[model samples]
Target: MTDMNNPDNGGHGEWPQQQRPQYPRQPQYPQQPQAPQGYPQHAQYPPRQPGQQQPPYGYPVDDAAATTVLPPVPAFDDADATTLLPPVPPLGDAETTALLPPVVPGAVPGAPPAAPRHRQPVQPPFQQPAQQPVQPVGHPQGYPQAPLPEGQPEGRPRARARHAAPAPQPAEVFDPPTMTLKRPPAPGPAGPVGAPPVPPFAAVPAQPAPPAPPAAPRGRTGSPIIEPGLQPALITAGAAALLAGGAALGQVALALVVALLQLLTAAGWFRLNGMWPARQGILLAALAGFTADAAVLLADSDGGVAAVVGTLGGFFLLVLVLQTFRPSDPKERFYALTVLGSATVVTALCTTLLVADWVPAGVGAVALATVLAAAPLPGPKQLGPVLGLVAAVALGLLVGAPVALGALAGLGALVGRRVAAYDWPSRFVHMTAGVALPLAVAAPLIWMATDLLA
Candidate 1:
């Protein structure tokens, strides 16, 4: 019966020729008591004998009657032997959730799914032994391979090569989870390309040294240091003596010596410890020397004006030298220059009298008067008085030539105190050069104008 139902068996109810057993058919009855002739024994079974029954396995009368009464089987074709199976149900939410990708929080829904990841497929769930955990092949005995969870399908290929290294990140960037990619080295020999060369340190020029500080103030000690006033007093006395003696020869010799000393001191080559004395004394001596020389040269002659002008020129030169070489104390320096200027005026007046034979009484008075007018201004406190003197002199000079000579002589002294505060050399150069130049041009003009006798 099982062989007849199997689709692989022959359909004609015949067993395979090679597999069939050869059996002899046994007659159930001796010809089945010979069916009544022509009545067709196929329609009726023979009557059974007492104590004898039908055969144990054979077509029966009841089965034949039951088949005749029942409805006909549906063609009894190949289709009747096949069974109908139930269809598979769709997946549930939990299964679907496991299969679907997790959504990023802010991403739009209903968007087309992202492109499939090209990675090696994940391993499928394995059929594990009921009580034993599956162990990885070639791994330690206790280290089991992590099995795919239940509810997954089989035969999924491994995801594509997602493990390939990522792109290299910049060094400055702070990567909490470090990137694993090994970047290719930047193109060539790692030398800086198109960059400015490192400048040779030797090419840089050295810086210049800073200037030294100016010299300290003269005669001024922060600690109240004592200084001798004798030099200044002696200087005043010597100037007084030269003016009073009036000896032409003695004056000329003294003045020449003083001029030489002054030049030496101004050059800084000599240090005469006479304090202000040497400078003041030198000025007085120079005045006397110039006066005496002019006197001898101009006596009994028309050259008295020349001698006077030349003496003035010498005095201007001396003032210029003093101004060019500044003293630490501007006040004292200008005071000394003022004394020299005044002496020059005195000598000029005296020349008019003694050398040119101008009347002594008048020239003496003029000389005395000019000397009184032209003196170094006393101090900062005396500025008002000195300025008054200056105005008075200017006023007098504009009125007469005699006063003009005195005004010129006194001019340097009066203003020198103010200008002395400046860089002495530069100021002195400017003033002396300005005055000397104009006078140089004017001297000849004045001589020509005055020389009516010539």
Candidate 2:
């Protein structure tokens, strides 16, 4: 066991190779964690208070671990020019504070912000806390009890305020409003209402139920939103009559037909409906028609339409331009244009019809017919019919129509007025009649004129 002379052996002046001292496993107090490197020692943690109890191994250091739980890293502020470090627990038991990752280097001044360090979630030594004593409601010393009133026992719960009689409710203080009494004189009034012996109720005849409205005419059940007040029929009648009269008489000419169609299309549909685009189209068309009419009349071919188209076209153009400039819903612009244009065209066509000739009288029979057709006869009773007949007769004779023609016109006008008055046979029926009747009346006259000329 003692090789004293050997250089490698354990001997005096040569310390022997020693084995690590093995001691019994003493109670291993959890090692405290050291302040992380690069962090100021002072910022790491405050010293533990004396007499503070340490938790058992693997248990939390209670307040010590809690204090360090939310690390107070310095704010990433450029003004301080300081590096932040997560608050490391005091250099003590490693169990209290697990070794943390090294402090992340902060951004150098004038550098782009450093990408944030992804920190591992600290698993706090979570344990249900020991039950603490129940705290007093207010101050720890306890609130002062109000002085007990006379006749009350001690510790009886104090009322928030001293009790007094409850204030009177409104109903108790003021009597409620009631229905005003119409009390009769005390027992003295067995009077008038009771005096009249009740007459037997006379038997009431049940009034006949009001007659149902007649069904809509067949073939036209859909709504009639906005048509000519007989406008379609009016056009057909006027167009057919114009064409027929022009063809049969040969003296009347096609200009009147053109004018009638233009008037009907513009005035009847477009203009009335507020179609601005259609109105503009009509104005342009009217201008063209005016030019054509002027050219034709100059050439002695189309004499029926006068240059009045130009005037109406200009007016309609102005209106449309104003409307175009006006603020309105964009969707309605086209319709508004059409309506305005059509109306303008119709008005111009009226002027054309006025100047246009059918039988060569200066006023023009076609023009007179056009006027009558375009106008309305809406007086209450037979007033329209009477006036219309008189006007027809006067106009017919004044315009040098035959007496037969005058009588025919009067009859036609009267019939048309009556038809118009009765709303039954569709609005178009009377309107067609109003426009067509004159042409029918004039047919015979046209025959007579042809015969005489031939």
Candidate 3:
């Protein structure tokens, strides 16, 4: 390689042929990877030396060729140039005039002759009338007139007279004449002034007394005291109470009865609230009841009531938490919580009977009361509740329980019946809640009463 800056090169900076270094021929590999099909193959360029400067890939290397001037393009002439667009059709004078191009003074040589002007016959100039003509009397001008009557002539004098009459004017308002009302003079020994005298004992034909208006048929008042299906409800209640009293002999047996009552309470409560198909709520409530019963059984006798109450509170919190996870609107969540919480409480109440010692006597009183209340005795509606209370007291005396215990049990049973009957309970309600609720309700009362009496 020769030095590019060497003066002996005559400032041309060219590499001399004799001084160029010999390089070894590159060894060809056996195979070169071919480019994949459809791809453009790039030319392999020889590697350049660090000192060599090359022109850009697309440009000519010679300086004179790069600077050569290109031929001048011919000036565009409108007349000779051909266009891709279709020829313009000839324009009418109106269209041409609308274009507003500079106007030539004379007629265009090749243009179509101007359409001959047909001067419309000159309309006589409208002259002002000496006097404005009067419009006809009846019909105004411009607006369409109504057709003349069938029998009337177009120029009848009578019809003309009718139209000519002045339209009646509206009456003026005036103060009405004022008069004072006076009471008639009463009949006396002198009688009315200038009236004929009547005999003292003369019988005037008695005017028939105005027939009294038929008294409005009185609408039926108040809900029926005895709900329908009371008979079946009474039988079911009595049977449940009897079974509960018998189950009192064994703790396990009583637990079973209580469990059954809990199930009925859950199912019936859901139905009562019109929340059918609330499988989750029903299962949750039933599970809570079972847990309460277990708690009661595991607890010491003294702690049984506390166990039930605590179980109730814990399950209520669980219900609230579970409801939070429910994918429901706030209204539906709130409604579910209310129905489920109430059902849990009522089911838990059944556990009280297991802890109470006077359960048999209390249950007996409940049965007696429910049976008496259901009887269709001939008396006022009050008689049923009255008889129920008396029967409960009598039952208590026979069973050797305190009078207050029996009364409390009886009252609780009646209340539970009322609850079951509310909102027009169906037959299913009568069978399930009507039977189970009486005992469930009485349980708490019996437990409390026994505690107090003890």
Per-residue lDDT tens digits of candidate 1, residues 362-390? 22222232233223446664564355446
lDDT of 2 by residue, 294-398 (tens): 544554434433245446556667767877886878767666666566445443443343233333331233334334444565655345445545565566578
lDDT of 1: 0.37
Q: How high is the CA lDDT of each candidate model? A: 0.37, 0.43, 0.70
TM-score of 2: 0.27
* RMSD in Å for model 2: 26.7
RMSD of each: 34.7, 26.7, 30.7
Which is the winner by lDDT between candidate 2 and candidate 3? Answer: 3
Q: List the pairs of residues colliding in candidate 3.
A: none
| Residue-level lDDT for 208 in candidate 1 | 94
Q: Which has the higher lDDT value, candidate number 1 or candidate number 3?
A: 3
lDDT of 1 at 132: 34
Q: How close is candidate 1 to the true structure, as a TM-score?
A: 0.23
RMSD of 1: 34.7
Worst 10 residues of 1 by lDDT: 265-274
> TM-score per candidate, in order?
0.23, 0.27, 0.50
